[model samples]
Target: MSLEVKNLVKKYGDKTVVNDLSFTMDKPGVYALLGTNGAGKTTSIRSILGMLAFESGEILWNGGKLDTSKINVGYLAEERGLYPKYTLMDQLLYFAKLKGVSKEEAKKRIKDWAEKLQVTEYIYPPAVKGKKAKVKKAEELSKGNQQKIQLMAALISDPELLVLDEPLSGLDPVNADLFKNIIKEEVAKGKYIIMSSHQMATIEEFCEDLTIIDKGNVVLQGNLNEIKKSYGRVNLCVKVEGDIENLIKEADLTVVNKTPNEYQLKVNKEEDAKVLLEKILQTNLPLIKFELREPTLHEIFVEKVGNVHEE
Candidate 1:
Protein backbone atom coordinates (compact mmCIF):
# COMPACT_ATOMS: atom_id res chain seq x y z
CA MET A 1 0.00 0.00 0.00
CA SER A 2 1.19 3.53 -0.73
CA LEU A 3 0.79 6.63 1.48
CA GLU A 4 0.94 10.06 -0.09
CA VAL A 5 0.78 13.58 1.31
CA LYS A 6 0.19 16.21 -1.38
CA ASN A 7 0.65 19.94 -0.82
CA LEU A 8 -0.08 19.66 2.91
CA VAL A 9 -0.50 23.07 4.52
CA LYS A 10 -1.32 23.84 8.16
CA LYS A 11 -1.64 27.27 9.72
CA TYR A 12 -2.24 28.65 13.18
CA GLY A 13 -3.76 32.14 13.10
CA ASP A 14 -1.35 34.18 10.95
CA LYS A 15 1.50 31.64 10.88
CA THR A 16 1.89 28.72 8.50
CA VAL A 17 3.53 25.76 10.20
CA VAL A 18 3.60 23.35 7.32
CA ASN A 19 3.54 24.79 3.82
CA ASP A 20 3.25 22.69 0.72
CA LEU A 21 4.92 19.74 2.46
CA SER A 22 4.77 16.63 0.26
CA PHE A 23 6.24 13.15 0.32
CA THR A 24 5.31 9.60 -0.70
CA MET A 25 5.76 6.11 0.66
CA ASP A 26 5.28 3.90 -2.37
CA LYS A 27 6.24 0.67 -0.64
CA PRO A 28 7.03 -0.88 2.71
CA GLY A 29 10.09 0.52 4.53
CA VAL A 30 11.02 3.41 6.81
CA TYR A 31 10.44 7.02 5.70
CA ALA A 32 11.96 9.85 7.75
CA LEU A 33 10.33 13.25 8.43
CA LEU A 34 13.03 15.51 9.80
CA GLY A 35 13.40 19.11 10.92
CA THR A 36 14.75 21.20 13.76
CA ASN A 37 12.60 22.06 16.79
CA GLY A 38 9.34 23.75 15.72
CA ALA A 39 10.24 23.22 12.08
CA GLY A 40 6.78 21.67 11.47
CA LYS A 41 7.85 18.01 11.43
CA THR A 42 5.33 17.05 14.12
CA THR A 43 2.66 19.24 12.51
CA SER A 44 3.09 17.44 9.20
CA ILE A 45 2.83 14.07 10.96
CA ARG A 46 -0.33 15.00 12.87
CA SER A 47 -1.89 16.24 9.63
CA ILE A 48 -1.03 13.00 7.82
CA LEU A 49 -2.46 10.84 10.59
CA GLY A 50 -5.74 12.81 10.54
CA MET A 51 -5.25 13.86 14.16
CA LEU A 52 -5.10 17.54 13.16
CA ALA A 53 -6.78 19.48 10.39
CA PHE A 54 -4.85 21.21 7.64
CA GLU A 55 -5.78 24.36 5.71
CA SER A 56 -5.57 22.71 2.30
CA GLY A 57 -4.13 19.31 1.46
CA GLU A 58 -5.02 15.70 0.84
CA ILE A 59 -3.55 12.66 2.53
CA LEU A 60 -4.20 9.60 0.44
CA TRP A 61 -3.79 5.91 1.07
CA ASN A 62 -3.78 3.60 -1.93
CA GLY A 63 -5.25 6.37 -4.16
CA GLY A 64 -8.03 7.14 -1.69
CA LYS A 65 -8.52 9.43 1.28
CA LEU A 66 -6.48 8.35 4.29
CA ASP A 67 -8.63 7.56 7.29
CA THR A 68 -7.29 6.03 10.51
CA SER A 69 -10.66 4.59 11.46
CA LYS A 70 -10.68 2.32 8.42
CA ILE A 71 -7.02 1.33 8.36
CA ASN A 72 -4.79 -0.51 10.85
CA VAL A 73 -2.47 2.35 11.80
CA GLY A 74 -0.34 2.70 14.93
CA TYR A 75 1.29 5.83 16.29
CA LEU A 76 3.85 6.48 19.05
CA ALA A 77 3.49 10.22 19.52
CA GLU A 78 6.37 12.49 20.53
CA GLU A 79 4.57 13.48 23.68
CA ARG A 80 3.94 10.56 26.01
CA GLY A 81 0.22 9.67 26.14
CA LEU A 82 -0.27 7.37 29.09
CA TYR A 83 -2.76 7.72 31.94
CA PRO A 84 -0.13 8.16 34.64
CA LYS A 85 -2.28 6.70 37.38
CA TYR A 86 -3.59 3.70 35.45
CA THR A 87 -2.11 0.24 35.43
CA LEU A 88 0.20 -0.52 32.45
CA MET A 89 -1.82 -3.60 31.50
CA ASP A 90 -5.06 -1.65 31.53
CA GLN A 91 -3.70 1.04 29.28
CA LEU A 92 -2.25 -1.44 26.79
CA LEU A 93 -5.53 -3.29 26.57
CA TYR A 94 -7.45 -0.06 26.08
CA PHE A 95 -5.15 1.01 23.29
CA ALA A 96 -5.47 -2.41 21.69
CA LYS A 97 -9.26 -2.38 21.92
CA LEU A 98 -9.36 1.01 20.21
CA LYS A 99 -7.50 -0.63 17.32
CA GLY A 100 -10.17 -3.42 17.18
CA VAL A 101 -7.99 -6.13 18.67
CA SER A 102 -9.76 -8.91 20.56
CA LYS A 103 -9.30 -8.93 24.32
CA GLU A 104 -7.78 -12.42 24.22
CA GLU A 105 -5.36 -11.51 21.44
CA ALA A 106 -4.46 -8.26 23.14
CA LYS A 107 -3.31 -10.11 26.26
CA LYS A 108 -1.20 -12.47 24.19
CA ARG A 109 0.40 -9.62 22.27
CA ILE A 110 1.07 -7.76 25.50
CA LYS A 111 2.83 -10.75 26.97
CA ASP A 112 5.04 -11.11 23.93
CA TRP A 113 5.91 -7.41 23.69
CA ALA A 114 6.61 -7.16 27.40
CA GLU A 115 9.19 -9.90 27.05
CA LYS A 116 10.72 -8.31 23.97
CA LEU A 117 10.90 -4.88 25.58
CA GLN A 118 12.05 -6.29 28.95
CA VAL A 119 9.11 -4.77 30.79
CA THR A 120 7.59 -8.02 31.96
CA GLU A 121 8.20 -7.19 35.60
CA TYR A 122 6.02 -4.08 35.34
CA ILE A 123 3.29 -5.65 33.23
CA TYR A 124 3.27 -8.98 35.03
CA PRO A 125 4.45 -8.68 38.59
CA PRO A 126 5.78 -11.84 40.17
CA ALA A 127 3.66 -13.66 42.78
CA VAL A 128 4.43 -12.40 46.31
CA LYS A 129 4.10 -15.90 47.86
CA GLY A 130 1.47 -14.81 50.46
CA LYS A 131 0.61 -11.35 49.13
CA LYS A 132 -1.55 -10.12 46.24
CA ALA A 133 0.04 -9.56 42.83
CA LYS A 134 0.07 -5.91 41.73
CA VAL A 135 0.78 -4.38 38.35
CA LYS A 136 2.73 -1.14 38.31
CA LYS A 137 1.22 2.18 37.30
CA ALA A 138 2.61 4.12 34.36
CA GLU A 139 4.08 6.72 36.68
CA GLU A 140 5.95 4.07 38.65
CA LEU A 141 8.07 3.06 35.67
CA SER A 142 11.21 4.84 34.48
CA LYS A 143 10.98 7.05 31.41
CA GLY A 144 12.62 4.40 29.24
CA ASN A 145 10.31 1.68 30.51
CA GLN A 146 7.31 3.93 29.96
CA GLN A 147 8.49 4.47 26.41
CA LYS A 148 8.60 0.71 25.93
CA ILE A 149 5.03 0.43 27.17
CA GLN A 150 3.97 3.13 24.74
CA LEU A 151 5.70 1.30 21.91
CA MET A 152 3.97 -1.92 22.92
CA ALA A 153 0.69 -0.09 22.75
CA ALA A 154 1.59 1.07 19.25
CA LEU A 155 2.49 -2.47 18.12
CA ILE A 156 -0.16 -4.47 19.97
CA SER A 157 -2.50 -4.54 16.99
CA ASP A 158 0.19 -5.40 14.47
CA PRO A 159 -0.56 -2.29 12.44
CA GLU A 160 0.24 -2.22 8.74
CA LEU A 161 1.47 1.36 9.04
CA LEU A 162 3.46 2.66 12.03
CA VAL A 163 4.48 6.22 12.83
CA LEU A 164 7.13 6.83 15.48
CA ASP A 165 8.09 10.32 16.69
CA GLU A 166 11.38 10.48 18.56
CA PRO A 167 11.03 6.80 19.41
CA LEU A 168 14.45 6.62 21.05
CA SER A 169 14.50 10.01 22.65
CA GLY A 170 14.96 9.27 26.37
CA LEU A 171 16.28 5.74 26.42
CA ASP A 172 19.68 4.65 27.65
CA PRO A 173 22.04 3.05 25.12
CA VAL A 174 20.87 -0.50 25.93
CA ASN A 175 17.20 0.36 25.68
CA ALA A 176 17.83 2.40 22.56
CA ASP A 177 19.41 -0.65 20.92
CA LEU A 178 16.42 -2.73 21.94
CA PHE A 179 14.08 -0.23 20.27
CA LYS A 180 16.25 -0.19 17.16
CA ASN A 181 16.19 -3.96 16.92
CA ILE A 182 12.42 -4.02 17.27
CA ILE A 183 12.14 -1.41 14.51
CA LYS A 184 14.34 -3.56 12.31
CA GLU A 185 12.10 -6.53 12.97
CA GLU A 186 9.05 -4.49 12.02
CA VAL A 187 10.69 -3.46 8.76
CA ALA A 188 11.58 -7.10 8.12
CA LYS A 189 7.90 -7.95 8.56
CA GLY A 190 7.20 -5.51 5.69
CA LYS A 191 5.54 -2.87 7.83
CA TYR A 192 5.52 0.64 6.42
CA ILE A 193 6.93 3.08 8.99
CA ILE A 194 7.19 6.87 9.12
CA MET A 195 9.79 7.99 11.64
CA SER A 196 10.78 11.45 12.90
CA SER A 197 13.84 11.90 15.08
CA HIS A 198 16.71 14.31 15.71
CA GLN A 199 19.12 11.36 15.73
CA MET A 200 20.51 11.48 12.23
CA ALA A 201 22.54 8.33 12.79
CA THR A 202 19.39 6.36 13.59
CA ILE A 203 17.68 7.79 10.49
CA GLU A 204 20.66 6.74 8.39
CA GLU A 205 20.44 3.25 9.85
CA PHE A 206 16.75 2.67 9.06
CA CYS A 207 15.39 5.12 6.52
CA GLU A 208 16.33 4.86 2.85
CA ASP A 209 14.05 7.73 1.77
CA LEU A 210 13.45 10.96 3.69
CA THR A 211 12.15 14.52 3.65
CA ILE A 212 14.03 17.27 5.48
CA ILE A 213 11.92 20.33 6.22
CA ASP A 214 13.05 23.75 7.38
CA LYS A 215 10.66 26.41 8.68
CA GLY A 216 7.69 24.62 7.02
CA ASN A 217 9.36 24.35 3.63
CA VAL A 218 10.96 21.33 1.96
CA VAL A 219 14.71 21.79 1.88
CA LEU A 220 15.76 18.28 0.84
CA GLN A 221 13.82 15.17 -0.07
CA GLY A 222 14.97 11.99 -1.79
CA ASN A 223 16.90 8.75 -1.37
CA LEU A 224 19.55 9.19 1.33
CA ASN A 225 22.28 7.48 -0.69
CA GLU A 226 21.66 9.67 -3.72
CA ILE A 227 21.71 12.83 -1.61
CA LYS A 228 25.03 11.85 -0.08
CA LYS A 229 26.47 11.02 -3.51
CA SER A 230 25.45 14.44 -4.82
CA TYR A 231 27.49 16.07 -2.07
CA GLY A 232 30.53 13.90 -2.98
CA ARG A 233 33.10 12.48 -0.60
CA VAL A 234 34.69 15.68 0.59
CA ASN A 235 35.02 14.80 4.28
CA LEU A 236 38.53 13.80 5.27
CA CYS A 237 39.56 12.27 8.60
CA VAL A 238 43.13 11.84 9.70
CA LYS A 239 44.78 10.63 12.89
CA VAL A 240 48.45 10.81 13.75
CA GLU A 241 50.77 10.94 16.73
CA GLY A 242 52.63 14.14 15.72
CA ASP A 243 51.23 17.59 15.08
CA ILE A 244 50.07 18.22 11.48
CA GLU A 245 48.88 21.79 12.05
CA ASN A 246 51.43 23.32 9.65
CA LEU A 247 50.96 20.46 7.19
CA ILE A 248 47.18 21.06 7.11
CA LYS A 249 47.82 24.77 6.48
CA GLU A 250 50.13 24.00 3.55
CA ALA A 251 47.45 21.74 1.99
CA ASP A 252 44.79 24.44 2.52
CA LEU A 253 42.29 22.09 4.14
CA THR A 254 39.55 23.52 6.29
CA VAL A 255 39.46 21.88 9.68
CA VAL A 256 35.91 21.06 10.64
CA ASN A 257 36.93 19.67 14.04
CA LYS A 258 40.23 18.94 15.69
CA THR A 259 40.64 16.76 18.77
CA PRO A 260 43.55 15.01 20.40
CA ASN A 261 42.44 11.81 18.73
CA GLU A 262 41.82 12.96 15.15
CA TYR A 263 41.48 15.83 12.73
CA GLN A 264 38.20 16.21 10.86
CA LEU A 265 38.86 18.29 7.76
CA LYS A 266 36.89 19.39 4.74
CA VAL A 267 38.41 19.30 1.29
CA ASN A 268 37.16 20.84 -1.92
CA LYS A 269 38.11 17.85 -4.07
CA GLU A 270 39.69 14.41 -3.94
CA GLU A 271 42.95 15.89 -5.22
CA ASP A 272 43.15 18.11 -2.17
CA ALA A 273 42.97 15.06 0.12
CA LYS A 274 45.72 13.38 -1.90
CA VAL A 275 47.91 16.50 -1.56
CA LEU A 276 47.38 16.46 2.23
CA LEU A 277 48.27 12.77 2.44
CA GLU A 278 51.43 13.39 0.39
CA LYS A 279 52.46 16.22 2.69
CA ILE A 280 51.92 14.12 5.79
CA LEU A 281 53.99 11.28 4.32
CA GLN A 282 56.82 13.67 3.44
CA THR A 283 57.01 14.79 7.05
CA ASN A 284 57.51 11.15 8.17
CA LEU A 285 54.73 11.50 10.74
CA PRO A 286 53.24 8.37 12.23
CA LEU A 287 49.94 8.32 10.37
CA ILE A 288 47.47 6.25 12.35
CA LYS A 289 44.51 6.74 10.06
CA PHE A 290 43.55 8.57 6.86
CA GLU A 291 40.19 8.32 5.13
CA LEU A 292 38.01 10.28 2.78
CA ARG A 293 34.23 9.86 2.80
CA GLU A 294 30.93 11.48 1.99
CA PRO A 295 29.21 13.86 4.36
CA THR A 296 27.06 12.08 6.93
CA LEU A 297 23.33 12.71 7.46
CA HIS A 298 24.15 14.90 10.47
CA GLU A 299 26.37 17.12 8.35
CA ILE A 300 23.77 17.34 5.59
CA PHE A 301 20.99 18.26 8.01
CA VAL A 302 23.04 21.05 9.60
CA GLU A 303 24.04 22.45 6.19
CA LYS A 304 20.48 22.43 4.88
CA VAL A 305 18.98 24.12 7.93
CA GLY A 306 21.88 26.57 8.23
CA ASN A 307 21.39 27.64 4.59
CA VAL A 308 17.67 28.13 5.10
CA HIS A 309 18.37 30.44 8.03
CA GLU A 310 20.84 32.45 5.99
CA GLU A 311 18.27 32.86 3.21
Candidate 2:
Protein backbone atom coordinates (compact mmCIF):
# COMPACT_ATOMS: atom_id res chain seq x y z
CA MET A 1 0.00 0.00 0.00
CA SER A 2 1.10 3.56 -0.72
CA LEU A 3 1.11 6.60 1.60
CA GLU A 4 0.29 10.11 0.40
CA VAL A 5 0.18 13.41 2.25
CA LYS A 6 -1.00 16.59 0.55
CA ASN A 7 -1.27 20.22 1.60
CA LEU A 8 -0.70 19.37 5.25
CA VAL A 9 -0.81 22.38 7.59
CA LYS A 10 -0.38 22.76 11.32
CA LYS A 11 -0.45 26.00 13.30
CA TYR A 12 0.21 26.88 16.89
CA GLY A 13 -2.15 29.84 17.23
CA ASP A 14 -0.34 32.47 15.17
CA LYS A 15 2.71 30.32 14.49
CA THR A 16 2.63 27.87 11.59
CA VAL A 17 4.71 24.78 12.08
CA VAL A 18 3.91 23.02 8.82
CA ASN A 19 2.70 24.82 5.73
CA ASP A 20 1.42 23.16 2.59
CA LEU A 21 3.57 20.08 3.18
CA SER A 22 3.11 17.44 0.49
CA PHE A 23 4.82 14.17 -0.47
CA THR A 24 3.91 10.68 -1.62
CA MET A 25 5.36 7.21 -1.21
CA ASP A 26 4.00 5.05 -4.01
CA LYS A 27 6.48 2.20 -3.61
CA PRO A 28 8.04 0.08 -0.88
CA GLY A 29 11.20 2.05 -0.23
CA VAL A 30 12.60 4.56 2.23
CA TYR A 31 11.52 8.22 1.88
CA ALA A 32 13.40 10.59 4.13
CA LEU A 33 12.10 13.81 5.70
CA LEU A 34 15.12 15.87 6.69
CA GLY A 35 15.35 19.22 8.49
CA THR A 36 16.84 20.99 11.45
CA ASN A 37 14.99 21.35 14.75
CA GLY A 38 11.84 23.50 14.51
CA ALA A 39 11.78 22.90 10.76
CA GLY A 40 8.35 21.19 10.66
CA LYS A 41 9.71 17.70 9.89
CA THR A 42 8.32 16.18 13.10
CA THR A 43 5.07 18.12 12.87
CA SER A 44 4.41 16.89 9.35
CA ILE A 45 5.20 13.35 10.40
CA ARG A 46 2.86 13.52 13.39
CA SER A 47 0.10 14.88 11.17
CA ILE A 48 0.59 12.06 8.67
CA LEU A 49 0.44 9.50 11.49
CA GLY A 50 -2.74 11.16 12.84
CA MET A 51 -0.99 11.84 16.14
CA LEU A 52 -1.44 15.59 15.84
CA ALA A 53 -4.43 17.73 14.80
CA PHE A 54 -3.92 19.52 11.50
CA GLU A 55 -5.77 22.50 10.14
CA SER A 56 -5.90 21.12 6.59
CA GLY A 57 -4.48 18.07 4.86
CA GLU A 58 -5.25 14.79 3.14
CA ILE A 59 -3.42 11.73 4.40
CA LEU A 60 -4.25 8.73 2.28
CA TRP A 61 -3.28 5.07 2.30
CA ASN A 62 -3.92 2.94 -0.78
CA GLY A 63 -6.17 5.67 -2.21
CA GLY A 64 -8.28 5.83 0.92
CA LYS A 65 -8.21 8.04 3.98
CA LEU A 66 -5.40 6.99 6.35
CA ASP A 67 -6.30 5.82 9.82
CA THR A 68 -3.54 4.52 12.08
CA SER A 69 -6.08 2.90 14.43
CA LYS A 70 -7.34 0.64 11.66
CA ILE A 71 -4.14 0.25 9.63
CA ASN A 72 -1.04 -1.84 10.32
CA VAL A 73 1.46 1.00 10.88
CA GLY A 74 4.47 1.15 13.18
CA TYR A 75 6.03 4.38 14.47
CA LEU A 76 9.20 5.03 16.44
CA ALA A 77 8.82 8.60 17.62
CA GLU A 78 11.76 10.88 18.34
CA GLU A 79 10.38 11.55 21.76
CA ARG A 80 10.32 8.53 24.08
CA GLY A 81 6.78 7.15 24.54
CA LEU A 82 7.27 4.51 27.22
CA TYR A 83 6.12 4.54 30.83
CA PRO A 84 9.13 4.89 33.09
CA LYS A 85 7.98 2.67 35.93
CA TYR A 86 6.43 -0.17 33.93
CA THR A 87 8.22 -3.43 33.34
CA LEU A 88 9.80 -3.61 29.85
CA MET A 89 8.15 -6.87 28.84
CA ASP A 90 4.79 -5.79 30.20
CA GLN A 91 4.88 -2.54 28.28
CA LEU A 92 5.90 -4.29 25.05
CA LEU A 93 3.07 -6.81 25.41
CA TYR A 94 0.64 -4.00 26.09
CA PHE A 95 1.73 -2.15 22.99
CA ALA A 96 1.43 -5.28 20.87
CA LYS A 97 -2.05 -6.07 22.25
CA LEU A 98 -3.12 -2.52 21.49
CA LYS A 99 -2.13 -3.19 17.91
CA GLY A 100 -4.40 -6.29 17.84
CA VAL A 101 -1.67 -8.88 18.30
CA SER A 102 -2.80 -11.96 20.22
CA LYS A 103 -1.38 -12.45 23.72
CA GLU A 104 0.43 -15.71 22.86
CA GLU A 105 1.65 -14.31 19.56
CA ALA A 106 2.82 -11.13 21.22
CA LYS A 107 4.93 -13.16 23.63
CA LYS A 108 6.46 -15.07 20.73
CA ARG A 109 7.19 -11.88 18.80
CA ILE A 110 8.67 -10.23 21.89
CA LYS A 111 10.99 -13.18 22.45
CA ASP A 112 12.16 -13.09 18.87
CA TRP A 113 12.67 -9.32 18.85
CA ALA A 114 14.55 -9.47 22.13
CA GLU A 115 17.11 -11.72 20.51
CA LYS A 116 17.23 -9.77 17.27
CA LEU A 117 17.59 -6.41 18.99
CA GLN A 118 20.12 -7.75 21.52
CA VAL A 119 18.06 -6.70 24.49
CA THR A 120 17.18 -10.15 25.79
CA GLU A 121 19.38 -9.83 28.84
CA TYR A 122 17.49 -6.76 29.99
CA ILE A 123 14.05 -8.14 29.23
CA TYR A 124 14.66 -11.58 30.69
CA PRO A 125 17.43 -12.19 33.23
CA PRO A 126 19.25 -15.52 33.40
CA ALA A 127 17.26 -18.02 35.46
CA VAL A 128 18.80 -19.28 38.69
CA LYS A 129 18.18 -22.96 39.40
CA GLY A 130 14.59 -23.44 40.66
CA LYS A 131 14.05 -19.67 40.74
CA LYS A 132 12.28 -17.15 38.45
CA ALA A 133 14.16 -14.38 36.63
CA LYS A 134 13.45 -10.77 37.50
CA VAL A 135 11.90 -8.56 34.87
CA LYS A 136 13.58 -5.17 34.43
CA LYS A 137 11.70 -1.90 34.53
CA ALA A 138 11.97 0.69 31.77
CA GLU A 139 13.72 3.17 34.04
CA GLU A 140 16.35 0.58 34.83
CA LEU A 141 17.62 0.34 31.27
CA SER A 142 20.19 2.64 29.68
CA LYS A 143 19.03 5.28 27.20
CA GLY A 144 20.27 3.24 24.28
CA ASN A 145 18.62 0.08 25.60
CA GLN A 146 15.38 1.98 26.23
CA GLN A 147 15.42 3.14 22.64
CA LYS A 148 15.81 -0.47 21.49
CA ILE A 149 12.82 -1.52 23.61
CA GLN A 150 10.75 1.22 22.01
CA LEU A 151 11.82 -0.03 18.59
CA MET A 152 10.80 -3.58 19.54
CA ALA A 153 7.37 -2.36 20.61
CA ALA A 154 6.98 -0.63 17.27
CA LEU A 155 7.92 -3.71 15.21
CA ILE A 156 6.23 -6.41 17.29
CA SER A 157 3.29 -6.49 14.89
CA ASP A 158 5.39 -6.50 11.68
CA PRO A 159 3.59 -3.51 10.23
CA GLU A 160 3.33 -2.62 6.56
CA LEU A 161 4.24 1.04 7.13
CA LEU A 162 7.08 2.03 9.45
CA VAL A 163 7.93 5.61 10.49
CA LEU A 164 11.20 6.07 12.32
CA ASP A 165 12.30 9.48 13.64
CA GLU A 166 16.00 9.65 14.49
CA PRO A 167 16.22 5.86 14.85
CA LEU A 168 19.99 5.95 15.28
CA SER A 169 20.09 8.97 17.57
CA GLY A 170 21.86 8.44 20.89
CA LEU A 171 22.96 4.95 19.86
CA ASP A 172 26.56 3.80 20.18
CA PRO A 173 28.50 2.74 17.07
CA VAL A 174 27.73 -0.97 17.54
CA ASN A 175 24.05 -0.33 18.21
CA ALA A 176 23.94 2.13 15.32
CA ASP A 177 25.24 -0.54 12.93
CA LEU A 178 22.71 -2.98 14.33
CA PHE A 179 19.86 -0.53 13.67
CA LYS A 180 21.13 0.16 10.16
CA ASN A 181 21.21 -3.55 9.26
CA ILE A 182 17.71 -4.02 10.69
CA ILE A 183 16.45 -1.12 8.54
CA LYS A 184 18.11 -2.66 5.50
CA GLU A 185 16.41 -5.99 6.24
CA GLU A 186 13.03 -4.27 6.59
CA VAL A 187 13.48 -2.54 3.23
CA ALA A 188 14.36 -5.89 1.67
CA LYS A 189 10.96 -7.12 2.90
CA GLY A 190 9.27 -4.36 0.82
CA LYS A 191 7.96 -2.29 3.69
CA TYR A 192 7.18 1.41 3.16
CA ILE A 193 9.40 3.38 5.51
CA ILE A 194 9.41 7.12 6.33
CA MET A 195 12.56 8.11 8.15
CA SER A 196 13.68 11.46 9.57
CA SER A 197 17.19 12.00 10.86
CA HIS A 198 20.03 14.52 11.16
CA GLN A 199 22.63 11.96 10.13
CA MET A 200 23.31 12.77 6.45
CA ALA A 201 25.40 9.63 5.89
CA THR A 202 22.68 7.37 7.26
CA ILE A 203 20.05 9.04 5.08
CA GLU A 204 22.31 8.67 2.06
CA GLU A 205 22.59 4.95 2.82
CA PHE A 206 18.84 4.19 2.97
CA CYS A 207 16.88 6.88 1.13
CA GLU A 208 16.66 7.39 -2.62
CA ASP A 209 14.15 10.22 -2.26
CA LEU A 210 14.12 13.00 0.30
CA THR A 211 12.54 16.31 1.31
CA ILE A 212 14.35 18.97 3.26
CA ILE A 213 12.22 21.47 5.16
CA ASP A 214 13.15 24.79 6.64
CA LYS A 215 10.88 26.79 8.97
CA GLY A 216 7.62 25.09 8.07
CA ASN A 217 8.35 25.12 4.34
CA VAL A 218 9.79 22.56 1.95
CA VAL A 219 13.06 23.89 0.56
CA LEU A 220 14.15 20.86 -1.43
CA GLN A 221 12.49 17.60 -2.49
CA GLY A 222 13.26 14.99 -5.14
CA ASN A 223 15.17 11.84 -6.00
CA LEU A 224 18.59 12.40 -4.43
CA ASN A 225 20.54 11.42 -7.52
CA GLU A 226 18.49 13.59 -9.85
CA ILE A 227 18.85 16.53 -7.52
CA LYS A 228 22.60 16.02 -7.38
CA LYS A 229 22.72 15.66 -11.15
CA SER A 230 20.96 19.00 -11.56
CA TYR A 231 23.74 20.63 -9.57
CA GLY A 232 26.36 18.93 -11.80
CA ARG A 233 29.83 17.96 -10.68
CA VAL A 234 31.06 21.22 -9.13
CA ASN A 235 33.13 19.85 -6.24
CA LEU A 236 36.84 19.24 -6.74
CA CYS A 237 39.23 17.43 -4.41
CA VAL A 238 42.97 17.27 -4.93
CA LYS A 239 46.19 16.36 -3.18
CA VAL A 240 49.78 16.83 -4.28
CA GLU A 241 53.29 16.44 -2.87
CA GLY A 242 53.82 20.18 -2.47
CA ASP A 243 51.69 23.27 -1.83
CA ILE A 244 49.33 24.16 -4.67
CA GLU A 245 47.51 27.09 -3.06
CA ASN A 246 49.24 29.49 -5.47
CA LEU A 247 48.12 27.45 -8.48
CA ILE A 248 44.55 27.27 -7.10
CA LYS A 249 44.59 31.08 -6.66
CA GLU A 250 45.96 31.56 -10.17
CA ALA A 251 43.11 29.43 -11.55
CA ASP A 252 40.61 31.56 -9.57
CA LEU A 253 39.04 28.60 -7.69
CA THR A 254 37.16 28.90 -4.41
CA VAL A 255 38.58 26.69 -1.69
CA VAL A 256 35.71 25.18 0.30
CA ASN A 257 38.09 23.37 2.62
CA LYS A 258 41.81 22.74 2.78
CA THR A 259 44.34 20.73 4.72
CA PRO A 260 48.11 20.41 4.58
CA ASN A 261 48.09 18.31 1.40
CA GLU A 262 44.42 18.19 0.39
CA TYR A 263 42.02 20.82 -0.96
CA GLN A 264 38.24 20.84 -1.43
CA LEU A 265 37.44 23.39 -4.12
CA LYS A 266 34.05 24.67 -5.18
CA VAL A 267 33.61 25.38 -8.84
CA ASN A 268 30.78 27.05 -10.72
CA LYS A 269 30.91 24.54 -13.55
CA GLU A 270 32.64 21.36 -14.74
CA GLU A 271 34.73 23.47 -17.08
CA ASP A 272 36.06 25.33 -14.08
CA ALA A 273 37.30 22.03 -12.60
CA LYS A 274 38.87 21.10 -15.95
CA VAL A 275 40.70 24.43 -16.03
CA LEU A 276 42.03 23.79 -12.51
CA LEU A 277 43.09 20.24 -13.47
CA GLU A 278 44.99 21.52 -16.49
CA LYS A 279 46.78 24.06 -14.36
CA ILE A 280 47.77 21.43 -11.78
CA LEU A 281 48.95 18.95 -14.43
CA GLN A 282 51.27 21.53 -16.05
CA THR A 283 53.23 21.80 -12.83
CA ASN A 284 56.07 19.43 -11.86
CA LEU A 285 54.29 18.59 -8.53
CA PRO A 286 53.45 14.98 -7.72
CA LEU A 287 49.71 14.47 -7.97
CA ILE A 288 48.54 12.12 -5.24
CA LYS A 289 44.81 12.46 -5.90
CA PHE A 290 42.48 14.49 -8.07
CA GLU A 291 38.72 14.03 -8.35
CA LEU A 292 35.65 16.02 -9.32
CA ARG A 293 32.20 15.19 -7.97
CA GLU A 294 28.80 16.61 -7.13
CA PRO A 295 27.98 18.33 -3.87
CA THR A 296 27.03 16.14 -0.91
CA LEU A 297 23.56 16.12 0.67
CA HIS A 298 24.87 18.00 3.70
CA GLU A 299 26.30 20.66 1.44
CA ILE A 300 23.06 20.94 -0.54
CA PHE A 301 21.08 21.21 2.66
CA VAL A 302 23.26 24.03 3.95
CA GLU A 303 23.07 25.83 0.62
CA LYS A 304 19.28 25.61 0.57
CA VAL A 305 18.78 26.72 4.15
CA GLY A 306 21.26 29.59 4.02
CA ASN A 307 22.92 30.56 7.31
CA VAL A 308 20.05 29.71 9.62
CA HIS A 309 21.24 28.15 12.86
CA GLU A 310 20.20 24.51 13.03
CA GLU A 311 19.23 22.95 16.29
Q: Highest TM-score, which number?
A: 1
Cα lDDT of model 1 by residue, 1-311, tens digit: 89999999999998999999888899999999999999999999999999998999899999999999999999999988799999999989999999999999999999999999999999999879879888799999888888999999999999999999999998899999999999999999999999999999999999999999998999999999999999999999999999999989988889999999699999999999999999989989899999999999999999999999998
Provide TM-scores for the models. Answer: 0.98, 0.96
Residue ranges of candidate 1 with Cα displaced over 4 Å: none
In angstroms, how far off is 284's CA in candidate 1?
A: 0.4
lDDT of 2 by residue, 1-311 (tens): 78889899899999999989889999999999999888998888889999999999899999999999999999999987789999998899899999999999999999999999999999888878968887789999999999999999889999999999999999999999999999999999999999999998899999999999999988899999999999999999999998888988988899999999999999888888888778878887899998999889989988888755443
Model 1 weakest lDDT span, ten residues long = 126-135
lDDT score, residue 91, model 2?
91
lDDT on C-alpha atoms for all candidate structures: 0.95, 0.91
Q: Each candidate's root-mean-square deviation in Å? A: 1.0, 1.9
